[model samples]
Target: MEHDLPPVLSLDIGGTKLAAGVVTFDGLIHGWQITPTRREEGPRPVLARLFDLGRKAVAEAGLPEVAAVGISCGGPLDTATGVLECPPHLPGWIDVPVGPMASEAFGVPYALENDATAAALGEFRYGAGRGTSTMLYLTISTGVGGGSVIGGRLHRGAAGNGGELGHVMVRPGGRRCSCGRLGCLEAYASGTSIAERAREALAAGRASSLSAVELPTAEDVSLAAAAGDPLATEIWDETTWALGSALTDLVNAFEPELVVLGGGVTRSGAMLLDPVRAAVARDAMPPAARAARIEPARLGAGVGVVGAGAVAHDLLLSGKSDA
Candidate 1:
């Protein structure tokens, strides 16, 4: 069972939380840790704590040494230099040299990747997209983001973020998005948007099961709909409809072999997937729909860490080749 391949340390930075773990070649995590990001305190403190958590993971995993480190964060970031450049999700996080910091902290090389890109790699290497040549990944959480595997390798795009699928227009000039755009798909299909829309509806005195709750999250809305609330059902159906519409366009353009959906909202299970699948089948070009299978991500909550680990390992492998 002994081989020369060493385990990699992976870290995922989000607006809400920071996660770190030691990941092996077999797509397993050794020591995993997650905690809130507390972004109001700004980058220096949060990043210092994140690196500290990485050290703790390395120790808890009982690995003698880490081969490299991989990091995943929201874009617009510089994967080439491992710098985070003003991600709107992480307010005030600008020009942070995360890669160099991680490398120096761990005394090993590191790779910084867009979180969506990392998720795509995770799904491609070990999850729903494993057998496919070209696949797209969408994570629908605090925001909607995307990445893809094209020609059998992860696509890094011109800016390294690759295809920003979530930004695709589903409704032209509709709701305003955090990205300052109008009617983008993320403005409709993401968990944040779902909850926001529901809250707005309820605040306007719409009657529903969720109206009784002081704050109704997306989960509340989904549960309310499942329990047969008319208003909640309407909102839930609209969410699925928007997702299907955007995905129909994506399927036509990418013609990927598979589409993987991840993040918290997908936990609604078939409520989210079934309709989107049917929509793609009905609306997308028949050839493209036939070519792609829309499915859920298999790695679940650990995808970001696993993905960052994979990115780190790949970067190390590439560096060795360059040497």
Candidate 2:
């Protein structure tokens, strides 16, 4: 029965882009296609475009048919009912029934997962967490998000979205988070926060090399910091400090064997990882610190699509609802 399952069509929805791929049971992807999300167009148009992307991916892969579709997107979503509640990234897109729509479009069942949770499963199954019993994954892109695999199983928690690791309180009464909370790790370590802090500093007229650039991004800050720009250094340090502090807490709490960091921010590689590693080594409980190794994600930019495909593959195997 398991061998009879068809390859899965996977879609990943993000604020900046939409990606689709045909994924086999082996966790390999083929016929991947990517396009800008252009979310200003609202849900109907975006979903239509997304479905079209799916069809294109299916056609490109030369598969006869796909058995299931798996969708991954940012949360505040209902995995049980497959409704996407107002995720802050996709502003003006609220309560869209993406799962049913995707299922209907494809004539197959669909599984919707929080992007980070699906990524965690992705890493656990095929990336850095492979063969490990417990692992954690964090994505530090436009926002910070996290998920955990514990006791050799994906942990979705009671809320369906397993862990809001980014929401960990790093500075009480400090910067406001998109979750409407103050002092969240996401408030400080996310790429958006890095750029905002740089912009705020520049707006206040702090003289720095970044002053010459308009709307610098986190990569810009990282590059500037690497080039010895003081302002960028400050921002980069604070970002790493926040990540280390939060990761220290998470490593202590979970005692995972590995922690995988992904997303656009991690492109800085050693610049981002070395400092966090140092902080965790210095601050976390000795046992937990010794147990966990933080590393960059192996799946790279395609993790979202692959993760969604993995979710669909799981659906085929289980024939049951997600946690």
Q: How does residue 60 of candidate 1 score in lDDT? A: 97
| Candidate 2 residue-wise lDDT, 1-323, digit = tens | 13655799999999999999999877788899999999999999999999999999999999868989999999999988899999888999889999999999998899999999999999888888888899999999999998899998888889898898899999999999998899999999999999999999999999889988989888899999999999999999999999999999999999999999998999999999999999999999999999999999999988999899888888877877332
Per-model lDDT: 0.90, 0.92
TM-score of candidate 1 to 2 decimals? 0.96
Candidate 2 error regions (>4 Å): 1-5, 321-323
Instruction: Please provide TM-scores, in order, for all candidate models, with all chains considered together.
Output: 0.96, 0.96
Model 1, residue 154: displacement in angstroms?
A: 0.3
The Cα error of candidate 1 at residue 170, in Å, is 0.6
Q: Which stretches in model 1 have alpha-carbon errors above 4 Å?
A: 1-4, 320-323
Error of 2 at 19 (Å): 0.9
